[model samples]
Target: MNSVLINGITMTYDDTGGGSDSAGSVLLLVHGHPFDRTMWRPQQGAAPGHRVVTPDLRGYGGTQVVPGLTPLSTFAADLAGLLDHLGVRRAVLCGLSMGGQIVLEFHRLFPDRVAGLVLADTFAQGETEQGRKERNDRADRLLRDGMSGYAHEVLDSMVSPATVADRPEVAAHVLGMMLAAPPEGAAAALRGRAERPDYTATLPTVAVPTLVVVGSDDVFTPVADAVFLHDRIPGSRLAVIEGAGHLPNLERPAAFNDALAGLLATVRESARDGADMTES
Candidate 1:
């Protein structure tokens, strides 16, 4: 894990040193609402040779929050700044839920900087203005009420029943992470979600290699949402992680990692073929 300043926000991040073939491109993992970069650790550990960059996101983890800045578009700009700071020319993006929204927004802002995309448990369009406000209101309430008060209720929606019963530690770890979030962090994430752009219109515009993955039992972002993204994003592939829920990376780490590795392979192969075509 490391730190860098982007858009005046001190962003905290971790990079998995890529394997032999990971040099030319990087994998940037964006976490969901209320979750820090640690959410991607299980998947990062499983995928070797891929330079994985996990940012705690503004207002999450150790990231220094920028005051007076609001709106979700700034978050996308923040990502572009991070890539510039790291000297990443172009990279593959793997983001979950809120993280997925970040990628979509970034693509709109910095399309040329992205090599490919992997959207997991995410959506392009959701939340009416009222829905957004209600969610934000609840998050504020939880932050004030102590995360533990809501953590138990959230677990059922986060992980599959099997994981909760079979992998209690997994649930506990996720719960702990949620509980540790500061009130400001939680509020900032809620605000970001509220201001997220409707990316459904941009789906067909994404021309890079792509993958849309989700757990079969993801209640927050259902399977239908993944299917919608797959059908809309030109040339993108879709994978349904079985026996998993919202947090598949934690609940089914192996499968999540494998899906990521596969997305990388597709991107690499595409790049290689494009080079050959240019040479010819």
Candidate 2:
């Protein structure tokens, strides 16, 4: 429920302490549509030795939508600015869906400030034609039929049928989160995704360590997409969690935690090496 003034909007974010990290780095988690930053709680608890900051993002939760900004990259810039405000020069950025897009854009905008990146159930680049049209259509549908009508369609894509059947409340909460998003905000957010560039071509050049994680059943952004990204991103790891769909971090928390722990260990060790090289 805490707020950070970024680009004139009071963006909401929560910074929860997670164990200790003498390395002086923070882990920033960005949530996808319909949900605020709280979607990342499971991963935050799993990944210790770093401060975890989950932001509600602009137009979500208590954050306001600002006028004049492009809405999408404006989000990236806002995130970077928030880091600056927090006196964090570099940190790992973990994003899901829209959050992944934000992470991509933020890296594009502020490369130096990013220590690493985690793109979960997100495309390497930008949106495809069908995807763009579908999101736009959903936006229009939400506006026309209202949140209640569009909630299930928007929320159900994240989890598999087995999950919905076993944990009905999980599905319900996710759907509720989608239903609760401000219409104008959701519309604008969709527009931002539509206009983003594909980052696939730029993956190899990414300076920071990257992790592309997906669920075995993520039809939204399949395992193939993660593999493609992994192949292109030099050393970036590709992790797939079973028994989940798009939201692996939420659906299969333990597996997500294990994958995350592996990545963090690798990154921290590499960072130590770089630190040593600098010291010498």
Candidate 3:
């Protein structure tokens, strides 16, 4: 629940120590749209020996929300400012859903600052014209009818039907997070997302080690999307969490954490090798 003024907004973030004597590489976890940093609770202590930071993207959680259409660059700039404020020179960026898109934009803007990338349940393509219309229409609905009905409407797609039926607690938790989101902020993000650039061309240029994770049953951003990213990103690895949906990190934290641990190991080894080369 820490707050810092970054990019002219009071951004809310959680900073957990990297359990190492030296300043270790950071693991910055970004949340999806309509959800805040709390969505990353399961991953907080999971990355021991690495600084774990989870921030509520502007307009969500404890952070101040600006009115009108908020671009993804605004979110990316907030992250850059946050890292500068924290004195962190580089970090491994992990993001989910809309958060994933932000990570891509961040890399595009600050490639040298990224040690690695983990994109979960997200896509690199921009929205189609019809998709944009639907998103805007949904935004209009949120402005008019509010979040209660909209939360329930999108709850089924956010997680798997199995999660809803078998894991009542997880389903309820996701619903609660959505219902608690500020309608205006959520709508603004939806509108902003509609205008995101096509990042497909940017994937192949990613020189850092990358990991693409997706739930086996994620209808929203299907496994196909993950495969698309893995194929495009030269050396990227893909992990499919069986039986989970869009929010696999919440629905199946253990599997998600394992994949993340593997990515961290690769990034750490790469950093060590680079340092050794420099010293030699």
Candidate with maximal lDDT: 3
Q: Give per-residue CA lDDT, model 2, range 23-43, as digits (tens).
A: 435788999886876677687
lDDT of each: 0.82, 0.79, 0.91
In model 2, the worst 10-residue window by lDDT is 65-74
Please give me the total number of clashing residue pairs in predicted model 3: 0
Error of 1 at 258 (Å): 1.6
Note the residue pairs that clash in candidate 3: none
The predicted structure with the larger lDDT, 2 or 3, is 3
Backbone atom clashes (below 3 Å) for every candidate: 2, 3, 0
* Ranking of predictions according to lDDT: 3, 1, 2
Q: Give the range of the ten consecutive residues with the poorest summed lDDT in model 3.
A: 16-25
Q: Could you give the candidate ranking by TM-score, starting with the highest?
A: 3, 1, 2
Give the better candidate number (1 or 3) by lDDT.
3
Off by over 4 Å in 3: 20-24
Alpha-carbon shift of residue 220 in model 3 (angstroms): 0.5
Runs in model 2 with CA error above 4 Å?
18-24, 67-71
Determine the backbone clash count of candidate 2: 3
Best by TM-score: 3
